[model samples]
Target: MVGTALGLSLVLLFLSVPVFLVFGLGSGLVAIFGLNLPWSTLIQVSFGAVTKHVLLAIPLFIFAGLIMLRAGVARRLVALAMAMVGHWPGGLGVAMVLTMGFFAAFCGSILAAITAVGSIMLPEMKKSGYPPAFSVVLAASAGLLEALIPPSNAAIIFSSLTNVPVSQTFSAGILPGLVLMVLLIVVVMIRGRAFSRNERAGWGARLVAVRRAVPSLLTPVIILGGIYAGLLTPSESAAVAVVWAAFVGFFIHRELTFEGVWSALKATAVTTTVIFSIIAMATFLAVVLTYTQAPQHLTAYLLQYGIGPITFLIMVGVICLVLGTFIEIVPVFYLTVPIFMGIALTMDVSMLHLYVVFTAFAGIGLLTPPVCVGIYTAASVANISADKAFPQVPLFVGVGVIYGVLMIFTPWLAEWLPSALH
Candidate 1:
């Protein structure tokens, strides 16, 4: 029954059906052909998934990102990044990476970082004589940091689902995220020398750019700092972010008007609805899998065949990497995490460790092939092809894998922050 449902789901996904639709169809198939489960369980699970308090973070984070983008925060950030890094070798690419990382820290959504920061930086890089392919690749790779940084909706979701402390998940990601960014910068620098050219901005001008962006730049400090300082909970910090973003956009930046607010809200609503819908569908699928004891069966079969826990984890990572090539991160999380959580628990894996490992794997998916959403987004913004963006994948994926392995071996990285919070 599990095999049939899995096969049907994959087939539907390959045929380009929406993820939620595929899940619903697979669940129906299981009900009709595999099991005699009541259909009403599906509705209950779907509703329950979205109704959780932790799920509130998703829409708020999305809305905050939209507000930042609408308020010209991306422009400010890019200008500041360029001012600081644009004079370096492959400076424009470096600026893109830095700006993307910065935005990711606050917004916690790769799509938001790519659309907001990439939209501005990609064109600038092209105009500045950076290779279009490099520009696109850089933007795409940098965008993945959105999920790595604190206040990330993905981190929040993973923590909530795994019952790990969200604060710990946020901190566990910090060093790994930094490591990945450094590797990305190195790759860009090595390839960037060929594209390096002179820019005319003086120190004075650069300082002025920094001054203009200070408010926007402080967004992350406010969010993460407040959380770390124990001044607010993650949810409260997210609320502060929304209010701060709105204030900056409307009053300080003067970019967010009534119409701008409406547009941002509409955009936020559409994205939030899509994400929550997938969550609902995945919830139902999870219930079906759990009720049918499919996870238990699979775990027992794998263990019976002599697959060790580490081997199982590595296999799970590999599967997620493959799925990521075809699907977006949010849906992948929704579908895969529940299935894997059961296995991790059976293996006595620490919830924090599992969350970090899974997140690292998910991060890898953001850079993988085919439907690599980050790459596609960066490519579109930079006017480059997805195939051209492939070369940059090695650096990004390498960093992600390295960090994932490190976190797996040394559980402290994933546990320290949350422990401190307690």
Candidate 2:
């Protein structure tokens, strides 16, 4: 019965059903018919799933991201980046990577990171004679740091699916995000030979840039600082983030207006609705998986078939990589994350290690060839053909793989900050 339901899901997914229905139609029905589970229980579970307090953080963060997007927050961060790196050879590249990492901390989604940061930096990178392909690819790939950075929507969703604390997941993602940022900057410098450097900003200019960016920079400090310091639950931190973002956007930046906030609220509604739908369906599917003992049986079957933890981890990476390329990263997550819990439990892996590391791996799919979402997003932002960014995919994906290998050896990288605070 479990195998049949799983197979049905694969077929329906290929046929382009929405993920929620894929879960409901395939797994939910199997539990109903095969196991005689009641639809009432499934309905109750789905309703309860969307009620998580931590989930509140998502919509608030989304609203904050939308406000930041409209307020031109990226420009200030880019100014700071330029002041810091603008004089160095290949400084534009350094600035771009740094801005993406920083903005991701303030902005919630990769879409905003790439759109806001890419809109500003791509023009500069081009004017500096950075290879067009390199510029677009860099924006698309490095922009993924938003997912690995704190205040990450990806981490929140992963936590929701796995019942992991949102704060730990957010904290766990930091080292990987920072490592990837450093690696990307190095790659940019190596490729920076042809790109021209900007005139160095003097101390006065640097001070002005820093002064203008101080308010923007403080958003992440407030959000993550409160979470790490245990002064705020993830939800409370998110609410505080919303209030702070509005304050900065309207009063300090003077770019965000009432119209912008209304628009952001509308956007938040749409995005949250879609996200909660997926979470609700995933909750139901999880119940179905539990009812059928699929996760348990699969773990036993894998062990019986001689798969060790090392092999299991590799398989998880490959699955995320492949699915991430073809599917949006979130849906790839919905399909796999719940099933992995049972397998993750049998190993010595912490949920933080598994989720953070795999989130990075899933990000690679967006950066990989063929159906690369990163390339497409970059292409759209650069107003260039997708093929232009294709060649740069391998180099960025290679960096992600290297990060994965690092995580495999140094679980502490993902776990330490969370532990230190715990």
Candidate 3:
């Protein structure tokens, strides 16, 4: 059954079938013919996979991001970021990275973050003489921070699957998120010359920028504060984010329109549907893998070789990087985590540390090619193509590799905050 399913999936993938269909059909074939399972089981798993109440956060965060985009929130954040960093060498690049970090905190969706911030910053970077290819890569790479920050769908999903506390999983992301932000800032500084033509903003200008940005800036504070203070669950905070964004965007800012709100709803629906479809398909594949004992057999194979923790982590990183090139994170997570978490637990590895490493590599995958969602989204936003942006991805991917290695050796990077909060 396992070999037949694997062969069918590989063939379908090579034939250019969409990934969700590949997994769904490949697994469904094995279940019906190879293993003789009832077709009704697949339906049950597919529907059950997406029924979590916490998963509501994904669409809400996405909707909030869309509303913010329509309300000119991205523009306000960019202005504040430029006022803070745009006077320095490669300052426009720096501003892109910084603003992406802020946007990531609110949306926790990489494509949304890249689309919103990229739309605003990429053009300014190009106008300031930044390379079009480099600008797209920068914004896309920075947008990967969304995978690590609080309110992240990936983190939320990880918690749901592994039985980790959602709040601690959210906390585990904060330090590494900051590290990635700083690393990107440094990369921009090293890779580019001073691009911004704007002189340093005077104190008055900076104050005005802050005033203009205040309403938009409250988003992260409200979301994070509510989550961290025990005042709201991640899902509830997401709900609050939707309402707050609508109120601020439509009322206080006076930029959002009824038409724009309708559009945001439509976009959110489309985004939500795409994500849920992948999850449902992947869940069916996961059920097949679990029943076939693929994870158990794989774990035994690795343990027989006396694989140590560091080497095991390296292997996981390699697989994620390769898979990420052609698959979305939802499928990747469903496919790999079941195999890995079992192995890691047998080795007494810290679940927090293991998951952080997993998520970080997954983020890097978003920066890789072929299936690089972040890069493609940013490129489209900039009216460019993947080939134009491909050259700059390697350096950013290397930094992600280094960060993954750091997470392996320094277990505290993902554990300390969660422990402290407890």
User: Could you say which candidate leads in lDDT?
Assistant: 3
Per-residue lDDT of 63 in model 1: 83
Writing each residue's lDDT as its tens digit, candidate 3 over 13-56 gives 87989878988899888988877889899899888878977787
Q: Between prediction 1 and prediction 3, which has the larger TM-score?
A: 3
TM-score against native, each model: 0.91, 0.95, 0.96
Q: Over 4 Å off in model 3, which ranges? A: 194-197
In candidate 1, where is summed lDDT lowest over 10 consecutive residues? Answer: 413-422
Error of 3 at 321 (Å): 0.5
Residue 214 displacement in candidate 2 (angstroms) = 0.2
Candidate 1, backbone clash total: 1
Candidate 1, residues 277-393: lDDT per residue as tens digits? 777777656766776887778778887888866887788777777777788877777777877787788887767767667777776776788777777887777766788878767
Per-residue accuracy of model 2 over 1-422 as CA lDDT, tens digit each: 86878788878888978867777788787878878989899889988878977788988888887888788788999999999898777899899899999888877777767878888888888888888888888888886798889898889888888888888898899888898888888888877866778888999999999999998899999998898887999888888988998888888989999999999899889878877877777776678777777888888888799887667878888888887876667777878888887788887678888987688778887777655777788789889998867887788888888877677667788999889878
Order of candidate numbers by TM-score, starting with the best: 3, 2, 1
Candidate 1 residue runs with Cα over 4 Å from true position: 197-203, 229-231, 388-410
| Model 3 weakest 10-residue run by lDDT | 189-198
